[model samples]
Target: MATTGAVPMITLNNGVEIPQLGFGVFQIPPEDTKEATLVALREGYRHIDTAEMYGNEREVGEAVRESGIDRDKIFVTSKLNNGYHAPEAAAKAFEDTLSALDIGHLDLFLMHWPLTDGGYVDAWKAMEEMLQGGRVRAIGVSNFKQHHLNRLFAETTVVPAVNQIEIHPYLAQDDMRDFDREHQIATEAWSPIAQGKVLDDAVIERIARRTGKSPAQVVLRWHIQRGDIVFPKSVTPERVRDNFAIFDFELSDADMSDITALDRAERTGPDPDVFDYIPS
Candidate 1:
């Protein structure tokens, strides 16, 4: 039996504990999501992050059920799609996610994106209601900048348990991460490797060689050392196994700083404040 202690846990502001390292299912085609997720579970990943936008929640749920792990042993996270930011739509979307995942309750649910024009405050209200209703253990926001989070703070009574964002060596998002820490909101890094863009950098390559770890492992260890929750996506079985193997090593303080200095404010995803387009 795989113990839940394989990965460290970060307690959220609301007292919900989540695995610091998890599996992300983004851009993974729905057809293959099940097998990939099952592989992750078998590899000892207790947390699984997926979103409605990814169109693979059902398959993720299937993987969970078929993995034969106890429901309480795995932590599952899903997000609201952009088009469903309205309060009513948000409520329905939550139910739909539950039905699709068939997990009975969600471990953590987040707003996929802060659609500024889409009444996110109201959507958050519905999320609060979801939490109060006992369907979700924790609620949070994704791709929300400091200002976006400030708006939620002003308009809502519940503080988000997390703020999932695009974070990699190239785009460290230091200021936003600091804000989340100050507010006791856990930060989750989505593209922790910058979609493989930073794996080939000279500095990262040097650290990888010195640590005798792959570039991917070095970068992921950086996120872990910085105390950010990260979920790297990979459909390939070997890569998935490799990603979960990051817990054994430690990076030197200088190596950590060297990687941190690689932040160039580059982003592989859209800026939250300016991104409002919903796919049609």
Candidate 2:
């Protein structure tokens, strides 16, 4: 009874469906990523999220091929590197990502960060062009705030397919999620468990005991019940399997509320508006 069945799918604005729960390779090293990804795939994860910034897209791709799962059957997503925010660089980076992953095409591509310099506007335009060429099924933004999305709406032609942001029990991001919902953009929650920061919370622990699930499971279920796409990352096999088991259970309204109430605007990552680091 670990997993009830297949994971749920969230349809993007452009009609692409992404698995509600996936495996994320953010801090996972290149050497270890392939096996880690394979383990998650073996444990029933159909979606795998990697990025140029993550420096492990190739390993993720290797796992997909080695998993023996059809490319179309598995959903893959990557991002344009932060340094490659210019229109031309963004276009080139997209090709490099596809080449590095050696995947035929990407299910989703994102502007990894909305740098303060405003280059994302043109980079997004380039992504829209890439989408037209059929290299990427849908284009999106990650770590973007409300005003950043507003700028895109004012000047861009296509609405983003999804917004991947930092969301955990401590940072519910209700306003940002609401904005994405209003615009028909699906919200994907990265750092869903706050990088182990929330596992020790009293409320989350209490609920975990009541549900007979792990603390991470309770927090992840809270995100699912809130209707956000969540991908929890772990190199450990047992944790990876445990994370995907959330689909088998439900968190009552009161439980969901208790977790939601823990939100205090805490963020484990940098604030999107001013975080301008470009990976070297």
TM-scores for all predictions: 0.97, 0.97
Per-residue CA lDDT of model 2 for 1-280, tens digit only, reads 1222568787788888888999999899999999999999989899999999989999999999899988898899999988998888988999999999997989999898999999989999999999999978999999999999999999999999999999998899999999999999899999998989999999999988998999999998898889899888999999999998887789889998889999999999999978999877
Q: In candidate 1, what residue range of length 10 has the lowest lDDT sum? A: 1-10
The global C-alpha lDDT for each of the candidates, from Candidate 1 onward, is: 0.92, 0.91
Cα-based RMSD of the predictions, in order? 2.0, 2.1
Report lDDT (Cα) of residue 249, candidate 1. 92
Q: Per-residue alpha-carbon lDDT of model 1 for 1-280, expressed as tens digits?
A: 1125658899999888999999999999999999999999999999999998889999999999999999999999999998988889899999999999998899999998887684899999999999999989999999998888888899899999999999999999999999999999999998899989999999999999988999999999999999989998898999999999998899999999999999999999888878887867
lDDT of 2 at 150: 94
Estimate candidate 1's alpha-carbon lDDT, on a 0 to 1 scale.
0.92
Off by over 4 Å in 2: 1-4
